[model samples]
Target: MEWLVPVLIVVALVVLIGIYLWATYNSLVQLNVRVDEAWSGITVQLTRRADLIPNLIETVKGYAAHEKAVFENVTRARAETLSAAGPGAAGIAEGHLQQALRSLFAVAEAYPQLQASHNFLQLQHAFVDTEDKVQAARRLYNGGVRDFNTKIKVFPNNMFARGLGFTEREFFEVADSGAVSAPPRVQF
Candidate 1:
């Protein structure tokens, strides 16, 4: 009877450990999936912005041919952003692209024709909307990363998290404070 009690206690402990591990693994998986979804949202916004850039450039090109430097900067920044690999790299590239786009828009302000053009106006609106969506996605992704990182860094979860090969995720950060420092100036 003494041996039976000890045996049952061992079985109960095993079951409890199994439950804990299962729950922890599932929680981590959900958090990772959320991060991925958030990244996808950002990617969608980026793709939309990329698609709008050429039209914007062309519209401005008609009236602002003398502004070759602005056009070239926007083109180069777009290319770099498209080629960026991960979240960190992409964020930096995106910041550069946004700054370049801002400069391009600033140049456009000097050309009344470019600013008045329907195509330019539409493209600008689209880009602004996409940027908003991208910012929102970044926030969501960072939030998910924060939660997941916290999970793996806490006491009991930390033990299992390390054992299960769960590692921390990097936050999606913008390198250019200028891109997000203030609201973009838009004029109708």
Candidate 2:
């Protein structure tokens, strides 16, 4: 029975290793899904904000008909924000969009009547609410990425993560974090 003892020990070790791999793989997949959901949340908020832009631009345009450059810049930035693909691309697009929006708000400030219009006021509130949601979504996405990256990089999981087709996720970050983190200050 000497050979039998060695054979049982080998089988036990193999089974333990198999269990570890299974658990690790499942955890990685779950984390990946979470990250994807968080990203989708961010995109949904961004799209809502993008939809608000045209109305905002039109409202501003009604008052400041001569500010063609500001209108065009805002439109271009909105398009970039809509078409942005990944976290890195989205970050850059967000910076441009924020700058364009600041310029648009600056134009609005020059026209007190535009700032006082009922439609402009309502749209401004909606945009601010959507911007808040967008920031929250970005925080959620980055948090998910942090958890997912930690999972794949930890302990024995690191050895098998790559082989299992798991990799670290990128955090959603903007070029000007301060600008994006806060709602644009639209002074009335």
Candidate 3:
């Protein structure tokens, strides 16, 4: 009877450990998926904003025909932002796009008539809404990255995470907030 009790205890311990390992692995996998989904949300929002750029540029062009540099910069930035991959590259590309947009709008400031145009007004509202979504998506993405990073770095979970291929993620950030070359102030 004494031997039987010890044997059963050992088996219970082994089973408990197995269950714990399985649970931890599942949690890590779920978190990894969340991170990926969050990043996709950001990409979707950015693409939405990018799609709006052409119409905005054309509307501004009618009034600021001489602002060739601003138009080119916006166009180039939009392309770069669209092509950018990963958080690090995407964030830098987006910041450049933001600056370019700010300058474009600043140029728009000179044309009161353009600002008053129905098309311009509608585009402005759409851009603002998309930007808001982008900001929200960025926050959600960063949160997911933070969660995944934490899971892969912490005790016990880290051990399982390593074997499971879970790894830390980079947060999306503006590379140079204080850069003298500022993006245009994008909002109304």
Candidate 4:
């Protein structure tokens, strides 16, 4: 009777440990999927922004033919961003694109005609809205990565995490502070 009680206690402990590990593994998987989904949201917004750039450039070109250098820079930046593969590479390319967009907007400000045009205004508004969404999605992705990475580093879970091929995710960082920071003043 004494041996039976000890054997049953051991069995119960083993089962509990098994269930705990299973739950941890599933939670990690869910977090990883969330990160991927959030990344997709960012990609969607980026594509929308990219699609709008051509139209914006065309409209600006019609009104500001003399601004060829600015237009070319925007085009080149957009192409580089679209071609970038991973998060790190994309972040660098995005910073360049953002700088170019800022220059383009600055040029537009000089031309009252372009600013007043309904199509140009609408496209600019849409691009701004898309940029906001992309930023939000990036935050969510980073949060998910943080959670997943933390889980995989904890004690018992870390053992199973390594065995399951789970690895930490790279953060999508902005390469340039100027790209994300407030616009610089151009006082006369």
Which of the numbered candidates is closest to the native, going by highest lDDT?
A: 2
Total residue pair clashes for candidate 1: 0
By lDDT, highest first, what's the ranking?
2, 3, 1, 4
The CA lDDT of each predicted structure is: 0.84, 0.92, 0.87, 0.83
TM-score of each: 0.94, 0.95, 0.92, 0.90
What tens digits encode model 1's per-residue C-alpha lDDT throughout 57-144? 8888888798899899999988888888778899799788878887887888888877878888888788778878888888998999
Best-to-worst TM-score order? 2, 1, 3, 4
Native-vs-model 1 lDDT?
0.84
Give one digit per residue, the lDDT tens place, for model 2 in 103-151: 8999999998988899999998999899889989999999999999999
Candidate 2 segments exceeding 4 Å error:
178-183
Segments in model 4 whose C-alpha atoms lie over 4 Å from true places: 183-188
Q: Top TM-score: which candidate number?
A: 2
- RMSD of candidate 2 to the truth, in angstroms, is 1.3
Candidate 4, 86-130: lDDT as tens digits = 678878988898889888888887888778888887887777777
Misplaced by over 4 Å in model 1 are: none
Q: In candidate 1, what residue range of length 10 has the lowest lDDT sum?
A: 179-188
**How many angstroms is residue 143 displaced in model 1 relative to the true structure, after the best TM-score fit?**
1.4
| Alpha-carbon shift of residue 28 in model 1 (angstroms) | 0.6
- What are the runs in model 3 whose C-alpha is more than 4 Å off? 179-188
lDDT of 1 at 134: 81
Weakest lDDT window of 10 consecutive positions for candidate 2: 178-187
